[model samples]
Target: MSTSLDTTRLLAALENVAVISTTDLQGNITYANDLFCKLTGYAREELIGQPHSIVRHPAVPKAVYKDMWDTIKAGDIWTGIIPNVGKGGGVYVVDTTVQPLRDAAGNIDSYISIRRVINDLMQNFEAVEFSKETFDEYYAN
Candidate 1:
């Protein structure tokens, strides 16, 4: 009926899935579904306070983040594919959206990231990995 109801339903439908996580502006693990914990091979206690960078895969470029931040800071949402290295050093790809969380005054306070497994997306890219700058340059318009 309403957006909150829709979100709740979505969460319920996807609760058994294990790849979704929500992070705060500081990159703190604010909320991580069971799938996220299982995928990362970390228990809830170990992840909640940790920065998202804990799972940062070396293959991810810094320039992607540079653009990610620039986009979010400007009050826009960022969507792209991210290849992340798991705790056990396994790599996986996902389509990700990083959105700014704004306060009552419309000031940005945090971020909420929604991700979907995108192994197929990776199959389409000839280059296995991309730098952040490289990604930005290609996507810049």
Candidate 2:
């Protein structure tokens, strides 16, 4: 049992900080929350009907997306750390979860993605990778 007040507060908190978007089965953007639009630098009107791949970053391995799609298409939720490109080519990292929405007839209707920016974590990871690469290069030479 949940009170309306509790639900409203939770919704408000998520809306204020979370990047949320929904896409059709074909991967066209159907809905994007205010936070998502602000982060992506796209107006709601511009995003609608556009492929969700618009924000995909080249640095992210293709296998990552393939796994995500395979899992969600199988009606399972997919969670991963994704590097995305924002407007103006700014790179951002997000901890993302995508879930398939099913219709009443048991068909997949769409996908809903919830993402939280993880800039600090991503920076640390990048630094670690760079250090590893530099050390390997020096020792190999």
Candidate 3:
């Protein structure tokens, strides 16, 4: 296949699997692609104009978000694995990349986040952490 064909295929695959969103500089959600709404169990009307934190899980530490904000605000990209809470309190995990979009003046206009779920890997990690916690509690006596 030609390079252009390969790039097109890759982008199609990414669109199929990735959840994408854009937020204004102050963190209000501006747009959410269909996959994002489906995965989060929110309708487009419900998601638009809401804070991106609408999907945040408490299990994710505040410091992680702080780091993401700090990095993006400085015009750098931030990437990390994040735990998120979906509708009905369901949990999901995603490998996320946050990028700042700059306006013509070189100031940030908005931010785009692309995320892909890592289901089994994150579930296993959560299981291990649970086991560790259980073991610690048992040994504390």
Candidate 4:
């Protein structure tokens, strides 16, 4: 049987392992967790106040972002593997989940995203030629 302490410790470890961030309704970064900053090669200050799109790779299909925004704004969760461009053109990929966060009154307030790096998986996908059609299939609910 797991105690509260065990649950707390598990979440703490998970937080450390995950790259996380929160963005306000306007899509500007509100919080950049340490792992997010480290993985993206950006200082926390550089990320904060910037659009969350700052990390998006140019080649990422626009439809993907559109779908993600539509899903999260409607208070649903969106999950997919995303290719991201880091500071100075560095590249990385993450299995990402973005969801809306609610305020005390149960109104949507902001969005929180949690991601796990999947560089190897993305590399394999790229080797097979990831395409717009494939992306659309992934975006399908």
Better by TM-score, candidate 2 or 1: 2
TM-score of each candidate structure, all chains considered together: 0.74, 0.80, 0.79, 0.81
Tens-digit lDDT track for model 4 on 1-141? 744567778778977989999999999999988888888889999999999999989889999999999999889999998889888788988999999999999999999999999887656766446675687789995
lDDT of each residue in 18-137, candidate 3, tens digit only:
999999999999999889988989999999999999999987889999999999999999999988988878888899999999999989999999999888876588786988899999
| 43: Cα error in model 4, Å | 0.5
Compare candidates 3 and 4 on TM-score and give the better one. 4
Model 2 Cα displacement at 41 (Å)? 1.1
Who is ahead in lDDT, 1 or 2? 2
Which model is ahead, 1 or 4, in terms of TM-score?
4
Error of 2 at 26 (Å): 0.8
Full-model lDDT, candidate 2: 0.91
Q: Candidate 1 clashing pairs?
A: 18-35, 18-36, 63-132, 63-133, 64-132
Candidate with best TM-score? 4
Clashing pairs in model 2, backbone N/Cα/C closer than 3 A? none
Residue 28 displacement (Å), model 1: 1.9
Root-mean-square deviation (CA) per prediction: 6.0, 6.6, 6.7, 5.0
**Candidate 2, 24-111: lDDT as tens digits:** 9989999999998888888999999999999999878889989999999999999998889887788888999999999999999999
